[model samples]
Target chain A: MAKTPLDEIRSSQVWRSIFRHGYPDTERNRTLAALSNIFLHLHPVRVRKSGLGVRYTWCMGGLTFFLFLVETITGILLMFYYRPTGDAAYNDIAALRDHVPLGVMRELHRWGAHAMVVSVWLHMFRVFLTGSYKPPREFNWCVGVILLVLTLLLSFTGYLLPWDQLAIWAITVGSNMARATPFLGHEGPGASALSVHGLPLIHSSDDARFGLLAGPLVGEGALLRFYVLHCILIPFVASILMAVHFWRVRKDGGISGPM
Target chain B: MLSLLLAEGHGGGLIPAPVRSAIDRLCDPQYFLPLFFVAFVAGLVFYRKWTQPKVAGGIALAALAGFGLALTNHNFLEIVERPDNIPIVGMLGLVAFFTWYSLRLAAVNDERIEKGEGPIEKTGSNDRVLVWPDLVFSEFIALILCTVLLVVWAIAVKAPLEDPANPFKTPNPSKAPWYFLGLQEMLVYYDPWLAGVVLPGLIIVGLCAAPYIDFNPKGNGYYTFKERRFAISAFLFGFLNLWVVMVLIGTFLRGPNWNVFGPFEKWDVHKVVVLNNVNLSEGFWIGWLKTGFPAWFGASPANGSLAQAGNVIARELPGLVLVLLYLAVPPPVLASTVMKGFYKRMGFIRFNLLVFLMLSMMCLPIKMILRWTLNLKYLVAMPEWFLNI
Candidate 1:
């Protein structure tokens, strides 16, 4: 029998290699379809019908991850224009906001950061309320928590990048709090205490606050440090933790369902 | 007295407290954590563990606590900046609670069997849908909808930008980002180390360790508030009541000098309250220790020696007892009563760990109350080292 163009392509080696299976008409091929593709493999071959219910899992975690991807793309685009310096930081943002083409990318990134924090929080809330953070899925929950903290850190560090009145003072207020971190801060409790010598182990210059801001205040050094943290360090750590989080979700028997 | 509660900053005089000053009211569970123990006891009686499961009792207790705290002040329903945000925040919280409540009534968990291989072991019928079309299609739609939302939001509200970073000219209020405003609010009530570093660190650590520390195995892979009532309730209290409340207070109530403003009051830059933010040591030394910190312990109590420290301690003995009771008492009580099953389930090691974390978590509310009620800035105030609470 003479095959049509569709059938011909389906039978051809090119299509066979690309798809690695038939049109997924049958159940066997459907499972294979998910198993064979890297992207599809992220999802299980077959998730329970119950697990698919939005009523149960609010789809918050997935939404958060999606927002993260949006942020990554928009943030990268923003990095090209952003100069995270003391003098030019605010000016650069103004330029990006006002003059740059597709300047809405900055807005998207900004809003996305806000949305991501919100979504991540909701995701955690959803998980906790549902008791999805139980045994067999315990460590994954820890990863999720770390991811939450990382998300907040990312938002905070990115906040300073704007270097405007809000950014400058907010970071100052936020970072200044660090100087009073009990054992870690120079001004904190036990920072001055020693068994033998009266010489304090940590002083104003040698505390967590000092390390965070290279000097005593939020100046040039702090701006540069925050930029690097906002751009590079936090995102790097977050992505790694996120990767672990997703992997663990799959490893710990996919998403939870009615037991 | 009314004028003090009505003082410029952080609250509306409309929401009256059952005391002389609203802050001085012996309420606001964030400070008076001992109140939680009362609620827990009442919940235990209300639930009667034999007949009921975990759901209704916890919610009732939550409601009770809410009702109690509302007696102090609830600006949640009050208007602040605009009308939209109030309904949004209100609905957001209400919807989640109702969803859980409705799900309980539905008995959604009972219809299903345990998972083995996949959910619904040996149903024999193929209830599973194909992933490629079914899952991907839904996700794609979600992606589109979310992107539209983000775009619309971006268009509607232009992300705010102010003058360039100026160290010299601090803003009038000099606020942190809206998110950290809660911590900033805490700073008004607590020492910087407690508000800024320790508390934040504790929250993170507690959250991360929650799953591992909790030993219950009933509500795995399912949504049942009944089986895990106490755990879920504690979380709702902390997350919604404490953290969310702090965020709200930080955002709306606080004004210049971090003084609380009434909801109806205009944020006039000139608005000022004559505040006497006296530390405990200063309060103790000047107020109580009329002569000097009993110099018997060491030379010159006022000379910043250990004797001076002892004087501060002796003066603030009531605060010390309250602090001790707030932190030390919850665990043994929980283990004996309401949280007994969990205590036994977790054993000594895990139980104590959870208790430590729980107590620390409880301290946030307790400290907050103390601030409001007594203007008690620190449970353990050490002025020289900048460590309070």
Candidate 2:
């Protein structure tokens, strides 16, 4: 039996160096080293020596990450079939529901979207409850909160990608609501001034929805903008933040436990 | 409603006819050509760093070549769709191959670093711990479950593209989605600016800022009751009260046609006319003082339908109750033995204020809900009233 390329790759000195750290040198020592390493800091430092089983901190953050990964995979697949044109978008979605060979991708993306929101909220609640956001971790907590907002933004942007009546009206109402913000609101001071004076300022009420959708209301341009945002822009930002978020946990001395 | 009177006469643009298919639109080289080039460049950079760390600069040069290729290929779609071309699949294979190779190369560099003789330096902290088995196994389990769920969902339902949008025909009850129904529900009770903007903005901003605002680090991994028991209890109570108010208003306050004013509604013409005639100073002085009487009030003249049911139950009762509630409840409650007990226990003055503010803000929604459920006729009778606006 000869070793396959994958096996050889796995056994290669480079693979061993990057993945395993120094060899365990020995099995027990390897196990101890694993327990002590910062990269694997998420694991419990010590198993219970007693007859009682290991105590697991509810890993809500890990679950949220898992859901996120699932979303990314499903989202990319959905992109293959989804067309972000105003005319075809709604029809395309309906077609996927009624006719596409693997229509379940749409449902998974939808349900996963809903589930991800729920999980992210729970993760935040869990962290709050655990006092994980205290002191040195406060900055990370802020980052996590931004990540949550981005998660929500991802959902909002993706919701419009389908370009159905539901998506249109929802975004309309949502953007209209955005227009009502005190300073930046469409009918607010800047907006009123813009309408009265015909200023080309970015903050003009006329430009509010246009700024967001990259064009007038939920039209062809809006759909393309949302598609890029949902698929490419937001996901890229979130992935980078997520990597920082994970690295920060190790830097912040792992998750908080009972005092 | 006053807002109806104030609304500009202009109508919004009609929804346009559906345009071309998304695939046709997106497939244009102008849209995706740059994207492909960027991805290729990124892949090359990653691949070179991972596989041949020593010659990683070569990958950058290769990326530049791919960028040039993408730039030159204007008819990418034609090439992709051609019978013999199979460009899309080829591109996918190329990306995957590069990614895999990069991973392998990176692994080898890591191994060399481990032996303490490679050009790639290992930080001392890298020696700390390496518990991949447990982490990897758990991750694998989670990944498998997620995959199964995805498969099940994909198998169960098919989502189709819909007919191109037709903007001309506005659907009746053009409401927002279910999540936003909660806010849409609020619009019926409050002013559009308040309902559509301020409240939702405040909630989201407040939610994002929760960690900073509630800096108490005393209790973690405990129920709300267990950690900062007073704050949590107050928050829950306030949340429940607000929820109840929202539900009541959403269900009962809004009219069938979403009208703030209707034929049967009482017009608030008197107030409007008075406000229009009298300057703000005079109106404010007379309105607020209960001393400087207006000429009409002084004369006590009866003025048609306005005078006919001047003291109708719907017209006067809610305002009376609201004034009384606002004036009466808080002081008595604040003076109560229970609140005193709470104040004594929660030593922080800000906590006391927060509790009071939470309870007080809950009243706006409550008052609005009450007016909606009980005073629809009054609202209808009132012609473009200030409150409605």
Candidate 3:
């Protein structure tokens, strides 16, 4: 048989060096293909046919991860134009909408965020309904729950980026909750009891809300803090947890089914 | 609230007045919540019957058709078409459809199991397929499809950006993001400490603790509603009724001043409902008893002394005792009665933890009912310490 151009390329030194497996036409090569690639290695060489069905899993978990990737890419593009400051943040968003080319980046990020929340929730629903969270997978379920929360926090922090009435009030409403963080919050139930020498330890300037906002209210400092959390801190934590979650999924027997 | 709306005007224009008023009455939170609970309970109870594919599909079609018809109305259209609220509308459909789909699958599998057959998922051959073409390719396709869907969505609906934030000019009925709207709705019934801090905290904690607390060995890696009825029902109640229903209420129904508006009702700024909330202490020591409160109840604790704090505690003793009884009584009674099996299965510590969380979850509904019926604001109102439940 004549060696096609694809075959010739596959046989090339650099191509061979890059890809440990040939074209995954044959069964052996297919297994090698999944096992060899860094990304594909996340999955086993072969998967149970039942687990692959869209009906069983709803593909929500994978879609959630994909949405995260979409958010990350679009978010990076947005960072180029955005200035997370009280003076410039809102203007930057306006610029993205009016001035910047393919301003759809901002829209994509926002919509992708909303989609991720819905997808993660649906993913949790699927897992619970299938009893995938039972037994040996319990720890991973906890990890998944934490990831779910981190997902919300990411969306919450990002909500402040536009710095509009919608952004500010929504965040204000959310952060107001911090003001009631038990002893940590000035206005919480046990906050009044936390005092030294009859001087209140929990106050407007020093409570959990203060710590969250880095001020008495959501101001420029909070904008900066949320920027970091949305772009850096929470994502960093979520990524680490996601890694653990995926790793455990593989480790604790991939794609649970009848034993 | 419904009467107020009705008395204001005959609901003329657009859809028929009778239909509009009927919807308005139903969407009132008092009726809405109980009706939602009934629907949820009915869904779970009749899962086997209704989750027959034909019936489930018919229901989904009817629901969508009804929703589509409702969108023809100006007032309902205005609310659902808001760019931010768009996702919530999608959420309503998606959650409903998926819930039905899942229950249908469970019904099929449960029937199969009863007939001494493996679940549909397990009935298929135990054959495995290559990940390269089968799994990876499908995942890549899903990725592409999601990308296309997201891009189309983004193009179709511009992300909402209201006026530049003004600290002085708060938006009427200021709301949290769509997902946290449930928690915001909770603030109506709870003190900020509980609604804002503790309840959210407990939700996460409870979710994390579920797998551990659930000791049942049946239904693992399978769908069987009959075997895991309690667990499934409890979870659905929390997720659908408590969380999603609240989100829906907050998004579509809540209007200016955090008042309820029917789907077909206009959001008038002037619309007002009296909310002269009274505490349990006041109901006990003042209203019902027809006597003045304890001496220190109304007195300011200026000294911040132990003696002063004692006076405040003494003043709130009625509320304090009632709250203490509420918290302390339920677990033992539940363990001995309705939840005897769960108590025996979960053991002392796990059972108590389960009961504690369950009661905590139940608190929102109980408090809401109290507020609705008696205009009761707080069970224990102690503003001196910023503590109220």
Best by lDDT: 3
Please provide, for model 2 over A101-131, each residue's C-alpha lDDT reduced to its tens digit, 9 standing for 90 to 100: 5446777777667566655755665465345
Q: Write the per-residue lDDT of candidate 1 for residues A1-259, one digit (tens) a residue.
A: 8899999988999988788888777888888888999977878877766667666566788899899899889888888878777767888889877886545787788878877777787788778866788877889998888888888888888888888888878889899988887777878787777324666788778788999988889888888998888888988998888888888887887777545
**Docking quality class, candidate 3:** medium
Candidate 1 lDDT, B192-215, residue by residue in tens: 877788888888888988887867
Candidate ranking (TM-score, best to worst): 3, 1, 2
- Model 3 agreement with the true structure over B133-252: per-residue lDDT tens digits: 999988988988998998898888787778997888899989999999999999999988999989999999999999999998877777779889988998989999999999999999
True contacts kept of each: 0.72, 0.31, 0.83
TM-score of chain A of each: 0.90, 0.77, 0.97
Please give each candidate's TM-score: 0.80, 0.56, 0.96
Model 3: CA > 4 A from native: B1-14, B296-304
Docking model 1 quality class: medium
lDDT score at residue A64, model 1, on the 0-100 scale: 90
Task: List DockQ for all candidates.
Answer: 0.55, 0.14, 0.79
Worst 10 residues of 1 chain B by lDDT: B113-122
lDDT of 1: 0.70
